[model samples]
Target: MVPKVPIDLPGTRYHKARVAADALRQQLTQIIEERRIALRNGRASAEQDLLSFLLSNGSDEEERGLTDDEIKDNIILLLYAGHDTSSSTLTSLFKFLAENPHCYDQVLREQLKVASSKEEGELLEWKDLQRMKYTWRVVQETLRLLPPAQGGFRKAIKDFTYSGFTIPKGWKAYWTVNATHFNSKYFINPKKFDPSRFEGAGPAPYTFVPFGGGLRICPGNEFARVEILVFLHNVLKNFRWNLVDPDEKIIIDPMPLPLKGLPIKLIPHSK
Candidate 1:
C-alpha cells in the first residue's frame, strides 16, 4: 500500500493526533535514555521520574524533540512483526529445505556466484543483495503462497458489493488471501513452492495482494522481504538445517503460523 492521500483533518482528528504525537516523543526519549544509561551506568536513573510524567504530560521538546506517537506505535507493532512474522517465514523455508535437500545445493550454488572468498565479501549489504535474484524470487513465491497475514477482517462503513454478494453498511468483511493463492486459474499448480512461477513474471494487475489491499495494509512488507532474504541467505550459507517435524503436522490452515511451531536443528556446514 502506498502512503495515504492527503485529506482535510477534522478539528477533533487533528487535536487527537497532535496529542498522541507529543506523548510518543516523550516515551521514546525516555526509553532511549533509559537504555543508554543502563548500558553506561549499569542501571537507570531513579532521580528522573520519566514514566510518571509520561502518564501526565511530558514534553522535552527543545532538547530531545516532540513526541511522535505514530512513530512510537509503529515501532512497537514492528516488534511483533520482526519476531513472530519472521519466525513463520523462516520456519517455512527450513521446512522446504529439509524436505527437499537438493534446494540447499541450489541455494549454495546461487550464493557462490554472488560472493567473494574474502571475509569482507561474506558480510551482506543492501547493494550486495541485488545479486541474489534467485533468492528474491523464492522468497517472493513463498510469501505469495504463505503470506504472514493469511487473511484479515475489514468492516464496511458504507454498502459495497463484491462478486454477487452485497455487503451493507456496518457489516464485517473477512478477506481471504490464502484462498486467492490456491486459485489454479492463476498458477498452473498453486500448491507447489516453485520459484519458477515468479521467474520474469511481472505482477498481473489484480487483487493478489498478500500484504493486503486498500487502507490499513502492513507497512513492513518490504522490510520483512529484505529481512527474510538476508536471514535466509546468511543462515543457509553458514549452517545446514534439517526439520525433524513431519509434513502432515504442519497445519497451514490457521493464519500463516505453523500448526506446531516447527522444531528444526541446525548443524554447521563445511565449505
Candidate 2:
C-alpha cells in the first residue's frame, strides 16, 4: 500500500508528485484540445482509438459528452493499467527466470519448439502464443509471487458472511493478491517457485487473481499475456542473460522493482 504524504509539504516527495501530476494534467489538456480541433477539421478518425471513440460517441440525443477532466482521468487509469502493470510483471519474470535455471531452461525449450515450427525471421502468431503453455505457467507462478498492483479497493454490494465474519453492505474492502496466492489452502508450498501448480484444473476459481476477478477484472489481461510471451520468445531465441547482481533486493514502491533496475550481462547465441 502506498503511504499517504502531505502534499503541501514543500521539498518533499509528495510535493514533487503533485507538481508532476499538475504538469501531466496540463499536457493531457493540451492534447485533448488539439484532438478536438483535429476531429472538427476531419483530420482524425473517430474509430482510430479509445480517446477518439470516447470523443466521437460521448454525445447523444439526450446526454452530454465526458468533460476534459473525466477523459484525462480515464486516460491516466488506462495508461497505468495497460502499461505499468505489464512492465512490472515483466521485470519480476526476468528475475524469477534468472534465479531458477531449471525453470528457465524449460521455458526456453518450450519457446524454441514453437519457434522451430515457424519460418526463420517470421513473427509469432496467435496460435504460436497458444502453444506456449509451460511458459505461461511460469509467468503465472511469477505473478503469484509478486503481483504488481498487490490489491484493489472494492465495496461490498450486500452483506456477506465468510469465516464467521460478516461484511456489511456499503463497507469498503481491499482484496489482497498475496493473501490468496500465498495461502497453502490454495497453493501447495506457496513460497516455492513451481509452475506445475497451474497444470490441469489449476487453482480454485478466484484464488489466483493477478488480473482481479468478476466484472471488475482487467480487460487487458490477455493482451498482457501475449505481450509477455512474445517478448520472452524473441529474447530467448536470440540471447541468454545473467544478472549482474544475483542477490539484488526487490523493493515495492507501489509496484515491485529490482533495487538496481536489474542490470544484466547478455550472452548472444552464436550464429
Candidate 3:
C-alpha cells in the first residue's frame, strides 16, 4: 500500500502509524529494562519466557548474542506476526462462518466431536488439535480468502525467467498473496469459499502459502495454527453467534478488517 503523505504530516495515517510505533518501542524498552533489572536481582528466572531467556543469555562477550535493540525488534516482530495476524484470521473466520450456515454447521459438528471426546473441564491438548482436520480446513479457507498479511517483499536469489519475463539477480520483488490465491491455475473456482480444497494433497507446494514459502517463511505459523484452532474449538463448543450485519464490508487498511469490526450477537449454548 502507498502512503497518502510523503512525510509524516499531521493528521495523516503515516503520522498516526509513526506515533503508534514510537509508543510501542518505548513500552517495549521499559519492559526490557525492568526485566533486565529483575534478572540481575535474582527476582526472575532465565527460563521464565522468551524475553527473560534473551536477556539472560545475551552476553556482550559472546559474538552471536543479540543486542538490546535486536531483542526488542524480534519481540515486536513476534507480536505482529503471531498476535495481530492470528486475530485478523479469527475475525474473518467468524464473519465467513456467520454468512455460510452450512459451513458453520460443519465446523460446529467437527468441534463438538473433539469436545465430546474430552473429559469434563479437560483442557485441549496438541493431539486434540491434530484431530481437528475439518475445522482446520475451515481456518485454511479463511486464511486463503483473507490472509493476515497481504504479502511480503523478497530479493531475487539469481536471475530467473518466468512467463517470458527475466528478473535480475539482485532486484527486490514484491509478491501479493491474493494474486496467487485467486489464480484459477492453482485453485478451482478460486472465488468460491471451499474448505475441501485442502482435503488431500492440498494446494500445490508453493501456492497455499498464507505463510510465505521456503526458509524465509513465518516461524510463528505453527503457533498461530494452535492458537487459532484452540480458540475456535472453545468458542464453537460454548457459543453460537450471528453477524449483526451479514453484509459487512471488508477493507484492507494494511490487513483485511471489517468496516464495523465484524459486530456479532452471541448466543450461549444451553446447558
Alpha-carbon local distance difference test for all models: 0.67, 0.89, 0.89
- In terms of lDDT, which candidate is stronger, 1 or 3? 3
**TM-scores of all predicted structures:** 0.67, 0.92, 0.92
Give a tens-digit lDDT track for model 3, residues 144-260: 989889888889989998889899999877788888799999998998999999999998888888899888888888999999999988899888899998888999978898999
Query: What is the Cα-based TM-score of model 1?
Result: 0.67
By TM-score rank, best first, the candidates go 2, 3, 1
TM-score result, candidate 2: 0.92
Candidate 2 residue-wise lDDT, 1-271, digit = tens: 7866476788988888778878888998888888878988999899988888878877332278887778787888888889999899888898888899899899989988999999988899999999999999999999999899889989999999889989999988888898899999999899999999999999999999999998999899999998999888888998878899998999888899889999988888783
lDDT of 1 by residue, 59-162 (tens): 33324533545335545556555667777777777777677666667877787666564276557777767777877777667677777667778889999888
